[model samples]
Target: MTPLYQVSDSPAVVSKKYFSRRELMPSQNSSVWQIQSGSVRTMTYLDDGTIVTLGIWGAGDIVGSALSTIEPHIIECLSAVEAVALPLDRQNKMVEALAAHVEQAEELMVIRSYRTVDSMLLKLLGWLAKRFGRTVDNGQLIDLRLTNQDVAEILCSTRVTVSRVLTQFEDQGIIQRLPLHRIVLCNQETLRRAG
Candidate 1:
């Protein structure tokens, strides 16, 4: 099977650049950065300085300000990142990236549409587990290192509310919190059914 973002037989030589956590990725209209490791969240601020998360991108995913028309587009590293710049001249590859971006936005919109914060958060956790988690003995481990504030930004909720809900989830055995903002989705299937 072919990789999702495969390079051509004669690919351009591009060096992978490292970015620290919370670092802002450099944007170039002529190219996009393909993630080699770690993850990033693209965001834009409203007039009131409220952050709106656009999307979360992981390995093999492409991201850049050029992909969005939102002013002040920013890609903030969620973890230590390694990425290589891919020229936008590759239309086919960029098309795939754009499609993925659209799909993710749609999915996130659905999750956010849930009436209650608990329901929205539950679905968001499940989505993240599916996309970025690794299977563990008991459940999937989400190692995104996302803060309560980060999650709140994604869901358009308050940090206090997110913290409370996360605690509630832990108390209910729905999730297990680990260090460095990691979480184990203890019973994602049950949560999915309940939600």
Candidate 2:
């Protein structure tokens, strides 16, 4: 990772106050930094007519891909958000980092393709278990704030189907749905087996 100061255009300025949600793009050669201080929703529009729910970026996760020969932005914030904006030069370095990151993300997508819809859900649960799980007294809880609609988009299924699958998971005690966009993973091993 590049040093934050080395990449910052204005190293002297750092805001303590959280930024509310907004969209941003690099100005000329500028790079924008978005830090999710807490849970926030996001939607990304692909070049195709399809839209993807990028889910929530928990605290300490960074958004914005700064590196690409062609402008690296294709994602947008879908709700009121909080983040930090950085200069373009620093963003360029971050883009280099993102290149490697994209490879891993793509690998995960490939894994998602090999399975049936039910398997996909289970795989997704497993992936989230590692990437975003928070240990609770009972089990690991996935911190991503996703609706069945969001899961449908990600899984390339209808919302109704996704909801049914989630219901099945709930019935099997594989997961627990909390109010306000939280999912509790009650049994990751069962989820893995189901997947």
Candidate 3:
């Protein structure tokens, strides 16, 4: 697949760089960064200081000031991240990339809003596999490390519930944890029909 924002000779894009884990990228009002490798999560705290996971973006994803007016937001690396710090002025110029970002974000919101835990988790895995995973012998391997807490925040559920559902999935041979804490979908059909 073509990267959303490739390191181009075009004057509109420049300053491609890497970001370490937990490192802060440009803030909400700053220039947008297009993911070239790895993943990033942009989030904000509630008045109660609770952390919210706004979005998880991998290669080919574009994020930052152009995408949202999300205030009090922080962009942190979930893994070692490589991205192009796109010029803010050119943000609206990349119509296709912007549309992809908006569509993925909305899809995530709808998937996470499912009433049942099984439905939510299953849909999330399905979407993640499609968006981030690569093909493997058994199934798609989502190479990102999504912890219980991360799942909890995305699904608006408790960590314990996330853990329970994950364990259940593993027991049922629907999913498995791999090295680097990556998740592998063992049964694509089962996940698709779970909800």
TM-score of each model, in listed order = 0.52, 0.47, 0.51
Per-model CA lDDT versus the true structure = 0.81, 0.58, 0.75
Q: Write the per-residue lDDT of candidate 1 for residues 1-195, one digit (tens) a residue.
A: 434444444545565799999999999766789999999998876444767777899998888865665567789999999999876653567566875676577557656766789988988998898888898987889889899999999999999999999999999888999999999898757446533
In candidate 2, which residue pairs clash? 20-81, 21-80, 21-81, 30-88, 31-87, 31-88, 33-84, 33-86, 67-95
| Candidate 2 lDDT over residue span 4-61, tens digit each | 4334345455333354445542323345445555445444433333444444565565
- Quickly count the clashes in candidate 2: 9
Candidate 3's C-alpha runs over 4 A off are 1-93
Q: lDDT of candidate 1 vs native?
A: 0.81
* Candidate achieving higher TM-score, 1 or 3: 1
Give the Å error, residue 49, model 2. 32
